[model samples]
Target: MASPSVPTSPPGPSPSPSANPEGFCALSPDDPAYRVFIDSLDYLTPEEVERVKAAVRFSDKAHEHQTRLSGEAYITHPLSVAGAIVEWHMDADAICAALLHDVLEDTGVTKAELVEHFGQGVADLVDGLSKLDKIEFASHQEAQAENFRKMLLAMARDLRVVLIKLADRHHNLQTMAAVRPDKRRRIARETLEIYAPIANRLGLNKMFRELQDTSFRLIHPMRAQVLAKAMQAARGNRKELLSRILESIRAKMDEVGILAQVFGREKSLYSIYSKMEEKQLSFSQVLDIYGFRVVVKDIPTCYLALGALHALYKPVPGKFKDYIAIPKANGYQSLHTTLIGPYGTPVEVQIRTEAMHHVAQEGVAAHWLYKDAEHSGADLQIRTHKWLQSLLEMQGADSSEFFENVKIDLFPDEVYVFTPKGKILALPQGATPVDMAYAIHTDVGNCCIAARINHELVPLRTELKNGDVVEIVTAAHANPNPAWLAYVKTGRARSKIRHFLRTVQNEESAALGERLLNQELHNLGVQPAEIPAAAWERLVKASGNRSIKDVFTDIGLGKRLAAVAARRLLAEDAIPIAATPGSLTIRGTEGMAIQLAKCCQPIPGDPIIGSIKKGQGLVVHTHDCPVIRKSRSHEPHKWIDVEWEPSPGALFEVRIDVEVKNARGVLAQVATAISDSGSNIEHVSMEGDPERLFTRLHFTIQVGGRSHLAQVMRNLRLIPHVVRIHRTRLEMEP
Candidate 1:
């Protein structure tokens, strides 16, 4: 692809140089920082350079009165960010956006002004990097989450926005010492939790390590200091050993007629700290603190180098991974192996082509840095684009939920699995077949009924392992189950499932709500179809709802009372009769619109009442339930008469308490008896002291109704060791 270009322009007037007593340079053309920033743009065409200079001048003018906490001119921060962008070989527009990024948020400059001076592309990039500071939020966390969501969505549209934002965060972290102690810690925590992980996800290893180490130092200064000292001492002790290993690998590669560039790699302090923390190991126990990277001419040479190294030292079994064949989800490719070094210390080695090395360090940025078709980061770009597109899929979620899902996606310790057709799919560790189905497509996920691993039927919740052949069996009528949410590991799967469920719930709730409202209107001597549009407009306005459907949804979700809504929809003088409303019939298929109360376990043929709960829809309870009896007196308006349809569509779960003798086979006998009675045990728990001769076994079982429950109790009582058996009712204080 051809590179982006910009128009040439003459330089604008320069501000006079000034300096503080502490030697901080003011905004000026003569500033050393500005000169260095200009020098770094050497890769850009002269015309592009001039355009970037224009942005610098504009930013300098806009931030003339502002200064950073470090006492330097505020323009220096943007200049530093732009310098990083230049180093990454970003196009002229990206550089300009970097210079003007803070102007929209920190100064009086508007996006319109940016567009007038620069271009819409530059203005959009700057706007994307800006925070939503002008809007009100419920808390600081919400504000931050919202700002992050905005930036990520913007990044989905233009990847340069994140590149510029990451550079901005990098500069801020570099000068964080001037910030207050508490503020520094907070910024460091956010950086470690969000930004660093994002950098890693984008395959920006160089930036990722720097961000992680800097944040670690700021967050835990003492621990960082101690770890630094230890690493330094360890480095000195291992220098000679690393040198010997490097020489041996080089000599072996030469003997095998393979050309390679070998160098020792030092582990970052944050990496060491994380290893120690995660593995519960002492400093000395952390092996492979130093490793080697072998960059060769081609893919074949990479494998040859790996073989040469293994021949020099005994290879550690189960410590080798060939990522070149199945690259990581982030598109990192290499061959890695651990070996016993000269003194038996474990030494890790990585083998890859020179092009892979550049990608391993620069990640997606390599697309700009290395434009050659062979060396370009096209694979990484494609992977990144797909992930960015998923951000759009997750847009309808709340800010906090979106932020959380993105965080989960950023940390993918992946396992590579195969489809039946031989295509490979990478998923997070502990991911289930549902995650795989979703990764394929949202429609596939919605219709997946079961999965077969290697042609053997397996549970949909089974955790996928490396090299497993996962074939999802989808049916047109199948739908995602709420229970799948408990085991699905990928954020894509989780968000997709939630979005589908929410969509279904809204539709179901609206239908149920309309029915309830219509029943109420009938009792009030009004027909829903006969209600005028003017009345609906008034009802929507009075209820603070956006539309008639919204009002119905509120009533369905129990946020608004259907009776009150029905009265509001009628003309003021229209109500004349005061008749009792008929009980609403529930067949237990209301989906999210109606929930069966666990406290009472009301089944078919039971006298049930419905309680409207905010955000939770209607909850059904047996009329004699202790919880209902206690709360009915306090909130009579929320209770509505409900009746069961002659044939309820689903089984009801009921709890039974069985006291049994402490015998080896007594629990099994009781379970078998309940099974013989045609009841399915949902859960069973043993309570009371084990030493007692008698213990209570609580069995939560699914039954058809009260008759089936009675049969189950009788069967359990027939067990020889059963002391007593009865249906259980749990009561809660009002």
Candidate 2:
């Protein structure tokens, strides 16, 4: 499923191109080497062909000095991709864009110039394919993730964008031998996992096949060549077997009143090797030989043809899929079955109407020509839009998550289920109901509570399967829990949940901001009306914001520092900075008596001590005041004179502690005596003994002076459970 399998066989007689292209697909429009593109222009309008011709002319001129590895003009590569676009029936701009896809990267053509010449659509398309090298990342993984994210976003805007990109990659991969070996391996590995699968999803079967084959050749050149030789040696008999099978099916269908086209499909080397490596199968065990598609006239005839096919051969059990009823996510609808033939050999058969055949092969590309087809019947437009919407959803997702989801969704294996209304929904295998919910509607994903799979309630995590009728039960007030993100598999689900979570987080944080602002206001002891409008202006100006809302948002989001905001607001003359004990000292309440304590110094950590001077109402200092440091420095107005009190008769509170045991009820017993003495424990500090036998406790308590403190100490000494207790806040020997 990870391989570049054939999504659709080439319709008419045009030979399907190899997935990993051949050497530099000789794309020069002037040259006859790549006229296959013009010959394959079976679906292009006259105007579209002219646009392609114009693209070729511009590309040839721009790449005048450029040459490819095979000594061909560089324009060949763009022309090569443009040719593929013609086959896909992409719009004229897409064709032109494909031809000029590499212009901004390979040539010096600016996006502006391209827009001026070819229009914005073509320029944007070319720009989308252009690699991003402007930013530096710490790792290649990060860079790759970002690049892929950019590509998907652009492609989501326009599917033709990625189409051009895929075409560009296809040509480069085909000619990767011209690159260094290590580079070749990187490109091949990336193509195998990403580009090739995307090709399959788009139903560009020819491109997908060639991409896988080319990757196998470059990535596993030895194995690829070996497989090539093996297929070569064994091809004669395989072709004979295929011919006999085709003849049998054709004759049988003719007899059954069903006209069908049957052709043999040889599996690509990448696919065969993948089967060998992934499943540990032998080459013979790998069924790469059988391929026959039956194109009928209508849907009922398609089912009829399946029966006719089964009538002719015994279908290998567990290998049948009815995609016609529940088409693939890419709008592919065919009845695929592996059948046992003569000699017990296995062959894969695809049965569909001619319309489904067009969709199966063209994928989204079919949308371009589907309505215009002479025998068109199926609703290709609707299916294409559905897949297109998924791509759009993927594009809108978190790029980091999208990268992971793409690895799963783009691969070929998929599961199709049915709604109770009989509508079919296709999803990747292992996708849960959450993925389905997201696929249905973003609202459904948010409100989904439970799901009934086939009329029985099942866990949301249940893995769905083909034709399982699912009904989702929803609640009006339901919301997406962030935890649901852990189990999500699709990009849409992940993105939807993340978006919800982000929205909720923002709302919660905004509420937190209001609370924080109110608390800070309370701490400042300032009534809302007390702060003058002029003062608010100065503060807001210092904060560098024109409005308070901006300030609140900044603080809420952690964008602005609290201390900086406080400092800016306090810069006004009316509001002065006040120091707490062991914290910065500043003036508060003019003429207030505040002294610096000699014990704790009130540097930055202490609870503040404030004493009213004779005329001053309040003076602030360190509670366990220290000897003076510098009184003033750069900001003279912010500083206030403070004196250090040595040993006051009043018991000066100080912080002290000792490491002690963490026995049960130890803290309770220590507090019992302090409660008994009726002295409040102002500040207590505790630390755990890592050795598991002790605890450290520090306390700053209100003591009446030395004599009163002595009485308190004597009381503390009476407690037998008490460990060592100190009375001083400063233990520094200096």
Candidate 3:
């Protein structure tokens, strides 16, 4: 039989191998396509090529019964994927892994078998690229998310996993015409949303552009057709102009004695479409559709070329960026500037050394492609490793949450900031000092209280700007505020803050939960220590908790009633004893587990009760507060007697309504009185018509206790234009 037709090559720079040799129809070791694949492995040793061929033979046998939607032998798919990997000049193991990637998921081949044949390194690589298809999931989205998480975590361990995976996806996208339209759209969306961004993040520009264009075409075929036609027309119209600019730049470089290769660059259709969709611009409104790239011999020559070009054309102010000085997070380095071309048409130019060009084009792949070149890909490798290491830091989040965080990190419009020591840190745009602090270290982030931007004190939430020298001020007593979640931009910072807060909340909840449970047990005439270990284990099992701590945490968070849990922990036929008199005590130091009810604003001196709110721990409210009284009758079982410690550890917030004349200075006078009484106004607002003679100024102030709140009110009574002052309670009885 004639050899199966070679699969079509994806949209990339690599050339497709010649057609299969005659009389080599079936998948075999002597297949000409396999020969071409092995020939392309010139970077590998002779022994390595033999190893890769062995893997190809093994994969061929394993997939002999499988066929793709295009009716081609399934081995052809792995061969195509391997060809893409070869184009990247990846090592022998990567090519071997690519060849055997689908074996675990598709065939009966085992990881151990692969290990025996190719050793542990190749086995691990293949395992990383394989999906979790054997496991059941709740939904398609969950399965997809989990697979993505698995692949990413694997990629974290070995960056080659992603390179191989991207290649596999690229080949799949190229052959996707055989897929159903709905599935095609889904794959296209996934490619555009996740894979393309990942390729861009990793600095695989060529692959990134190709993935984007193909996905865009599949997702919006009509739009792509229209845009392609429009772009073609625009290209034809601008050809002469682009030629003139290129010639002028070449002449200028020669005149300045700067040896440079200047070539005109056309923007990809997907890029043009994205620009229009993002900025709501028409085709003609997008000015930088055509640009030029100047590749020079050295870094100094790159700057010299830039000067020559600027002299040749009028440079546009504020459109120049020196990424060469501060490379991008992905280790891309180039100088970009926009200029006024002939007839006032805009022209964008990029200047970079030959080495930088390789990096700009290949990104992390440059590390392998140019491994033997004079310019070692060490910088690119380090940058890529740093980013991959961060993926490891993002563990502990659930699958969906992990996927979301990674997506957030993938699309970075970077802003470069400097530490006090002058080390540069690249963060996503809109990143705050908190992100910078986290970028420095997790300890610094946890203890950071404020920042000094350019040596001037600023809020921690201040958005970092390019070239700003930031100094984070940390306090040992400081802890991450939950509010940081609203402003943090980096996934690392967001995840770190969330993880710390969760830990603190869990610990506080467990402590409070134990106290609540013990109180209930005492009410039932039992002591916690008297309960045996077996009873504890049974309680944990019955409560659907992993451990006794989890059971207490559930009770503390109000997910399970402490009274019911206490009863379940004891024997079924135990004798009743006399009830206890003490109630659960509140020290006001329970962190997030014990919260003061906003409506009642209970303080230490108030006769307070606790309401066990689901997922919100215990909410303290004054006994006579109308808000609590309304809900008291409906969920009486949730309400528990709570007494405040003689000395509560923290200040309590309470609201006071001050009726005053509608004068500008009257409000300031009341605030001054509260301040003089050693009370802080957390918030202040006005009610009623401000134009009227009388208005109400509401103040939410933090005070020590009931006596302190009374003192502040007494001070407010002494102020001028203060008509009446009373503590504000939500819907209280007169």
Candidate 4:
């Protein structure tokens, strides 16, 4: 174990890419590659250095007979990857891990043998980096997704895993020219979508920028070449303008009594191209292609430099941000401002302390690289750890959900808002009050009924803005409304809400299934209390379910019919269908388990009949409903005779389609008609031929039963300009 010496800050400007546009590629051992790797380990203890040397020797020996597609020794690939880790000044274990990352996947090396030779730390890192190729997958996408999930989960546990993986990907991308054209495009797409974003989030700006440019070259070579040439031309033309801006900022800083390091940095080609495409602008219109960073001695000096720069030129309103007051989630802190420079050009500038500059560039890796950066770097590590832990918390989420969450985290264009208690909370842009509540806590989200933004009552879906103070209003009885899913921005909020809805739905379905199964059994003269254990087991076995409850749940969910399950569990000819028929008692309290068919909403006096849905419990339909008429011919055996009880209990929903003249007050008038008839409109929809003067308005109204609905319909027919008023009986609209 060794605490490596801190590396000095890298130079301000990037070298010309035209010299080696493919970026870093593997070098032969006869060249400076091995020496460079060895020199990078100078900070390691002698013992640790010996361990790394052993890993390098083992990897070289294992790959002695292999060669890369570029006709270079295979060992050079891992050597190059290890060189990257060493450059990052990673610890001895990470260095060793980088050296042997490909051994397990590409060679005949076993994890057990690696553990015995290199110790568990190195072995575990290699294992995490290994792709799961032994297992079979149905498609390439499936295998890719599963492996990505595996890699991400491992990275969540050990940040070094992803660091090593990123290094591996970096080298692979650097040498992508040797890969087949089609395969190169696939790898480039994955790099652009996944690896590049991960590097950006970790604050590995160098890798992030390189990966993007490399992938852009591989996937769209012509476009990348054109952009590169354009950038080169722009560099020549803008050199004097940039020089003037830098000189002005330096003079202004001197006057303000602030000592700083000011330098101009060009945006990466991919970055510039992305901005142009996003804004639908030409290259000339992209004014912020070149930005300046002013590294001051301390935090106070950063603001002083910013003020000096702002005073030198006209500041672009709303383009100034103080990240020092509210750092980014990645722990980057700086003061960013855009000013109209020498020729009315928008010049973007960032001001930060020297330490902030390092953290901004190196991100979490700075913690291990720079001893002096430990405090701020550790703060970033803590933040990163918390976010990773959130990913682990969502481990039970399905693959699609987990992958979607990772994508959501990839691009965090955040808005910083204040809570009522003065604590700041960061949320994605377009986040609403419900998203705010969920970000606070799941319980708070579940109970949230209303919200007050900036001390004024606001709708839950109101999008929050930066600096707005948000206060959530919760109620004891309030629960998550499914409508919240439409506006929530965070994956956590969406997942939690979906989990709740799914759990509630399952429970309701299971309860309904139990009630239906019991009623069907009773119809066969088998009382619920009298059912034997063997019968339950038999039913479970026949349905291929794990337990009796699962069978009930499936039946209730409309995947199975209760009568069929009951018949399977009963003895042959135990009771005739007409012999001991028992009636199903109805109560509106059935919730989601039992449902009244919306196609023909049946009321107490509507002569109702039950149809055993495969997964859904009994669906009660009016006897003459057209849905029943159509389904009876195809599924006659599923139909069950039923009658509503004297006390139907609770409100019944019925659909009414009204044809009305396209007048402004027609909707209001129809709503008034239903309201005045003692019926509540649950939902409303209006649509019709735009060329015609009449429109079709459909309403789902709540009432006591069929008689109540009839009266409401009669009252609607009497309204002026109401051409036709009729109940819609089709289960689903055509």
User: Which residue window of length 10 is worst by lDDT in model 2?
Assistant: 1-10
lDDT of each: 0.85, 0.66, 0.84, 0.81
Give the Å shift of residue 338 in candidate 4. Answer: 1.0
Better of 1 and 2 by TM-score: 1
lDDT of 3 by residue, 184-302 (tens): 99999999999999999988899999999999999999999999999899889988888888898888988998888889888999999999999999998999988899988888888
lDDT of 2 at 207: 74
lDDT of 2 at 729: 42
Runs with alpha carbons beyond 4 Å of true place in candidate 1: 1-25, 372-375, 541-547, 573-577, 659-678, 686-695, 710-724
Q: Which lDDT tens digits does candidate 1 get at residues 55-136?
A: 8877877788899998988988888999898888888888888988999899899987777667677888889999999999
Q: Which window of ten consecutive residues has the lowest lDDT sum in model 3?
A: 1-10
Give the alpha carbon lDDT tens digit for every residue of 1-734 in model 2.
00111121111111122211332332434457457776666566675565555566667767777898877678778877877677666666777778888778877779877766667767777787887777788778778877887787677667777777887898788776678899889989899888888778777777788888888788777887888888887787577777788899999989998877777667777777878899998877776544777888888988898898899999888999887666665666788898898888887888887777776666666666566432332354345445556656655455566687667566467777787898877777788888898888999999999999989999998889877889988899999876777677776687778777666644544443343444345445545566667766876677787776556555555555433554456553345433441222332211112233435534322345443222222235553434323332343333223333333333345454644467788777777666676567887778876686777777766654345555666777676655676655443312
Where is the poorest 10-residue window by lDDT in model 4?
Answer: 6-15
lDDT for residue 157 in candidate 4, whole number 0-100: 69
User: How much is 142 displaced in model 3, in angstroms?
Assistant: 3.6
lDDT of 2 at 572: 35
Question: Residue-pair clashes per candidate, as listed?
Answer: 0, 39, 2, 9
Off by over 4 Å in 3: 1-35, 138-141, 372-374, 529-551, 573-581, 623-636, 658-678, 689-694, 706-734
Question: Across residues 35-96, which tens digit of lDDT does each residue of candidate 4 receive?
Answer: 77887898887877876766777777667678999998898888889888887688777888
RMSD of 4: 6.7
Task: Indicate which candidate wins on TM-score.
Answer: 1
